[model samples]
Target: RMELLEAFKTYFQQGVANPPGNYTSYIIKAENISRLQKLAELLTKNHIKFAFGGNQNARGFNYDRQKEESFSVGRNDLIVNLHQPAAVLADVLLEPKTLVSDTNTYDITAWALPYVYGLNAYASKENLKGLYPSLDLSMDQDAKTNATQLPLAWAFSWGSTENAKLLIALQQANIKVRQANAPFTIDKNDYPAGTLLVMRAENERLDKELAKTISKIATSQDGIFKTISTGFVDKGKDFGSDGYPLLTSAKVAIVFGDEVSSLGFGEVRFYLEHDLNLHPTIISVQNINSIDNAQVNTLILPSGDYKDDIKEGLAAWVKRGGRLVLIEEAINGVIGKKGFDIKKRDTTTKKDDQKENFGSFANKSKSNFDDAIPGAIYKINLDATHPISYGIGNTYYGLKTDDLIYKPFVQGWNIGEINNKSLMAGVVGKAVRKSLDAGLLIGSQDLGRGQVVYLATDPLFRNFWEIGKTLFNNVIFCDY
Candidate 1:
């Protein structure tokens, strides 16, 4: 599915993929604003109630240009909408009338251009004369990096999931890598804490043509390789300092259970293999006892159930320097257990349980189930100094489906927190609004030599959230 998606995204401009059904989706390859208006007028004349949306973010369904943030260049995605019959298209929207409301149907059906046709398009309320350029998809990927003189090491800004791919690709090619734990200025460019560094001293006997080998690997992964001259930096921590740590090849195993979220599991697998180019060992809950901490360093448990023995084994593994990553509701497995136990926010109160309903029984029952969060986006406040937040900014946007709130861990670092649990997008119930007023989104609890990493929300929601993907990569690569 990801291969097809990537192919569609890569070749959609060349008219390679077939348009699903008969929906008027287009790419404005011409640098003409009037072309966009002409198409909009045609739809308007047809009396089709349409909306303009950015090509990137899945928000802006029934999009109002005035209400949403301006979809400017170099900022938000400027993609066209997938126009179909109201009856067919509205079935996937996140409204009450949306047909795919079974919760088990899909992760997020919010309209996204990349998931749909993978092109740059836009519609406007007014004839705003925006400087639009035709996207040149035929550019050479090999030209991404120049053949610079081989210095002491190589480095690149680790701000995107693409950077993670480069790091993984280098490691797979048997190239040793190191990550800077502090900021540094090389030449004139200032890199943040999570900047990936490939030192020559580490990979001396690995390859004969080392510089070209790394450049080629980086180009294949669509990463810009910046050559480092000397370890001595103009400012910030130097390489000899405790700022640079050798990155280890990820020895990971994802625990898949019978009742575990297939969506979450699939997302983890897809992001790890398809996106990041790392193949993780697949472990079933029945085989949880088979997990040898000596063989695997990181154990990822998606949202699902776990037996007492499995949980107990996980606690011991974590104490023995094994990384345990818990996603969404999976944290419930070890919440009350020892070694990995952490405090959860108390949301239950007498006000809701008491007889305070003034509506019909049918409506009351509907409201009870309606409290289940479908999906929503929220602002995250992160400790920028922390390694987990190296590439991402202080404010990270995450898409959350469940109310898996946790209290701050006194012993561990709350790398990122949602100070205000207000909805940036998507619908939410009043009860959920009050319950998730504020909570931790990303944290780590130190058990012994190992740690239990917590992700309160599904970062790779439906395998879309680009920013969230970076955060997820941090959980795997940077949070050592």
Candidate 2:
């Protein structure tokens, strides 16, 4: 019940657009000791009508059905059942067909209420698939699946994306917005035969006339008004092979460090495999270490302890103009250290450090990590408005406890201080980096000819896990 109430608060008060009319809905579902009870109490305090029916029956109302319209319900007769079946709830809320009237509004004649609306532990597999079609374990489904995801709705949100659009509009209202590349691969020849290209007239006057002309030009175009093309190239095969000016070449250099095979190498490879035209050369520095022959623009030093000479060589590489990205602790401990202090002691027992402990990498699924990291933390300042963050939303990175940077039981990660004094922000929760402290805790530093971006936590790599791909993508693909 509290979760439902929180959902209501999230929808109504958390900056989401509201419907025209003030509609009050009484939700019924299985009640456990969740966030629902608190919500019910809050609603009661607000004088909102709420009735709870234990199990299935109460006051002559069937838990599964909406009372007939002919039967009158008093203002105080709100009934909510916690144990009704989802099918019954759906039968009460969603009408089979929508009857549209002259006003373009719907008159739902056979509506049914849905008890459960999203995927959860209590949800059946079929229902979860139905609710999240895009997440359907099949690629056969079409755009219908994509349209249902909450992310799409957020794209046109009131703030982030919308604000960017408004800024663009203000700068040059008649200017055409174009995509550097199509979201999906599409050839110019594949356009429909009847397709037409329409351009808005370049006008100095920023008025409704210009807006109307743009609309008219758009309406006169081909089958439909798809996204505009900026003529910029993307990290696609054709873009890479042709070698456009907007594109550049980069090679990833993997330096041997802790969790080398398990963490560092895999991440570097993941980028190369997914991104077209990007090449990488792996250089293991376990023995004789020198970066002189490492002809690479970007170097990734995975988390681990290394010899002092290796650290010196890396510093030299940076001084000569190479981008260095480091994770966890490496030689010399450039970041995240109380101070430069090192000590060693013999193990009390000769049992090799008490037989070591092991667990899942970051204790998260790949997909959850993918989405949660970017959306979780807050106040991620860019490196002086660089191309990586151009037209990109400021994102938060997620750090799990197992990663070397994780601090156990610390409410949030500490992004370095502003001016070396104020508190740093970070993500506060387990999945999403939702706090200012977390962002500050995982910060970036620029030095010499090289740029060092510190990802405080290891970003999980599975398709469903790496929520912060865009953040990483920007860093990797930007024109730095």
Candidate 3:
């Protein structure tokens, strides 16, 4: 649970207006056996006895209240973390769903705490060093960011969610922030595009208070105010160039109601409130027309059907310089409508599927079952030259659940697209896989003064998908 919360922090999410969530959780961090033995030693010294499960000294869990009495436990379910994860994934992909159960299953069988919680993991073929003398569960102290002396400006590489949190913090503090649209080198250190610059000249009012304010922000969000001294770079845009665009804090709104996906809505809500220290307006599709762009400049629509009377108004609003963001199925509705050139990739084929398997009901049921995509990982080709893809790499791992595809983004900024629909993880069906092969996943165009951004998948999917979290908020923060 703490790790899950840490993941949120790593994404640089701070003061995000989070809906109160309460649940039972425990972190099983076994760095080494000695740590467990040390814990056992302490517990035993205090007259508390326990049994070690899943070890060489493995004994069935049975604990007694008295010193000599046998061990006892209440009803419980023990779930071991799936190590060497390839085998199960292969089974799900290769085998038919009916092989596991012909009847409709209660829910998706996949229960992964790691990816679901947005925790990072690496599958190592070799074991890591596991020697431990003691387990230090100590938290990090408030190491406030202190500078020896302020340079012409303070520079921060736009990497991690922490930098994102800092960017919003500086914006909120009225400290003039600028983002470099091109990669730069300063003090022999190279920083990529989207590097943040807080010019000392712009914020003369924050002369002495600048570092102090940054410290407060860091302490509050557990942020790392890691900065590089700003100077004339060897390559790329200079500090005084127009290549660096001034950035403003975002006034965000997430579309809520029966038409939207609650999961999608909640993820964005949690991210904005907790990660970026912003409380987004929770407006409904019913209030689409009523959305005063003055109050909420940025509107995000999570995956759902909203092509009613509201969608047209919403698209019109975008042309008026309102920042409009769409995720997954929501894009399905508004494609080829107004202010967007994205066309939905047809799921239907010339040869009728039903007609081919007309006599076979079982075959038809199997085919229908196979079409479902329960969060498959896809590799996207991102054109990082665009500001939307800033801080994000050339390739993005998109977790695609919906097979919502668009024709090649001939118009606007084709920031992200799937060339081959690279399935990195999870099971993808024959039909959906083919359609997902080559299409635009993320595209944006300037609609009038406003902009319309289309996302083929929700970047804030289940509050997992780390890059998506950054990319989702990028719509609000990114200059482009």
Who wins the lDDT comparison?
1
For candidate 1, which ten residues in a row score worst on lDDT? Answer: 57-66
Per-candidate RMSD, Å: 9.2, 20.2, 13.3
Q: Can you tell me which runs of candidate 2 are displaced by over 4 Å?
A: 1-247, 257-261, 274-279, 286-289, 292-294, 307-309, 335-392, 402-439, 461-464
TM-score: model 2 vs. ground truth? 0.37
Which consecutive 10 residues in model 3 have the weakest lDDT in total?
A: 58-67
Query: Under the 3 Å rule for N, CA and C atoms, how many clashes does model 2 have?
Result: 47
lDDT of 2 at 301: 68
Q: Predictions ranked by TM-score, top down?
A: 1, 3, 2
lDDT, residue 357, candidate 3: 51
